[model samples]
Target: MFSPTSFDSRRRTLVSWLLPVALAGACSLAWGQSASDWPTKSVRLISPYPTGGAPDAMARVLADKLSKKWGKPVVVDNRPGGNGFIAIDAFKRGAKDGHDLIQLDSVHLAAYPYMFKKLPYDPAKDFQVIAPIFKSFMYFVVPTNSKYQTIGDVIADAKANPGKLDYGSWSIGNPVHLGMEELAQIAGLKLQHVLFKETTQLYTSVANGDLPFTMGTAGTAGPLIKAGKLRPIAVAAPYRLPAFPDVPTVAESGGPKAPYEVSGWNVVAGPKELNAAIREKIRADVAEAMAGADVKERFINFGYESLALDRKQLADFITSESARHENIIRRAKIELD
Candidate 1:
């Protein structure tokens, strides 16, 4: 028979070895479970646009797809006011997890820092960008019955009339406003800016002849253009859009084109300091969703160009875009009220 001391020693050794193994297995299981149990409840996707806008449309599509992927409901909260501060603020104040996603425009990230004298938030520190949702180039549009047929015609008329050429946009620092400001500056013409409550109002004013010209996304103006209420004179892109094959690019439209290719874009981002695993999962799923045929078709129908970028790439891109806008805004001396 084994001595009691020897048996006790062997038992202690076995227990010691099994304890570590069991603990490790438990830790591994818990780690896996935490990831699997993510999105414990409904996800909130806050949008900075009102109803019937492109961002809202895209968010609803994304919400539905993400809901299916996460096995949870995803809702798009539309809060449209205070130049996107209201929605963004709510997102910041809400959940710190990846469930609180926000649809942000590139201008909000890139140009606002330079445009505003004092911004309310620090974008670099307050958010982690997961991916770019979509892009839409601006269309230099006017009422169909207007005499200005081309970009050059509009420039000539604006020069002759000075500040009488009134252009409209939803806000002052938005890309629709700043891009036109840059174009007008390059062309050396005097123009007046008329701000409206929303994109529908801004584009409607252009169609109603209340506003002579405005740079807007295709989704905002394409229907009116198709309805003969608006005419696109120039596309703020390097090449003409496939959908608008007849519309000329800014360079081709005889305008003084100095990098007039800044397109408006929206991005997906989560709350600050969210868990990295959840963020990565969100990014991966969104990338997969963007690859699907239905999402692609929906984006196309909304006049949005799909762009796919991973988390790191999107972060780097946002940094570079902010730097680029800083240079342009500083050179142009664009200051807002």
Candidate 2:
């Protein structure tokens, strides 16, 4: 039989061991609860474009609204260049705790994978889709004073003078170039692609009568169209935009009714492995912010169609867009240098 003192000593030792385990459990629970209550500090929104571009502008607007709504400073960081790989790399290195978010676009997430032989990041594995902010219509525009009134007229001219007619875009592999190529394939007309280094130059060339026309996002073309320097011939969207009710859609513009839709989409994403609770919180806040009256008005002013899709919806849309762009790129034989 064991002595009473010995039994008491064993009990004490057992208690000593169990106390630490209980304390550890408590600490873990506290930590998890704290994490559940996220946005304890400022949130960083990374924009992969220059300061004046549409993506950057959208990021600023969202950051302002989110900052006010959450009572936390949401900073917009512009890491422009390197085809958005620079900003994406910065985002990957950020905290996985959901304090860092990236404003990603369809080109970087959907089209770049197929356009380039090897992309720097993996769309499926590197990022988690939080929510979609907005969708911008892609417009085919010409000088307001030009004689060609419709897409058919442009196609007729291109066919009549195959290599003489030129259309400009910001760069190769951009949606403008790819969309024009897709349009050319459908219309059975070849065009000389005039590449510009920036949208300002591209639009200026068109506005100055140096180039006949170009394709651009509504955000970039809205002010120009409103100012009467650019005339929208057709919008490559599913339906007519509310902002531009008079403009015809590609389907309505005498083009092949096949889905020739291309638009600039803005989505919020974080590095892979973000906590589910934090992700849901941010998504909910952003969706709510987007639905607010001020945000909606601003989106309309920028000619963006507000989209407040949840994670599953955003994932599905991204997947479909990826497949759609893959087919379009393959058919157009578009490869980046």
lDDT of 2 by residue, 178-254 (tens): 78888887888888998788788888789778899888877787778888899999889888887788999877877
Name model 2 segments beyond 4 Å from true: 1-35
Enumerate residue pairs that collide in model 2: none
What TM-score do all the candidates reach, one by one?
Answer: 0.84, 0.86
Q: Write the per-residue lDDT of candidate 1 for residues 98-185, one digit (tens) a residue.
A: 7688998887777786677666776645666666788888889998888888889988898899889888877767777677667766
User: For this target, which candidate reaches the highest TM-score against the unseen true structure?
Assistant: 2
State which candidate has the highest lDDT: 2
Give lDDT: candidate 2, residue 271. Answer: 61
Cα displacement (Å) at residue 153, model 2? 0.8
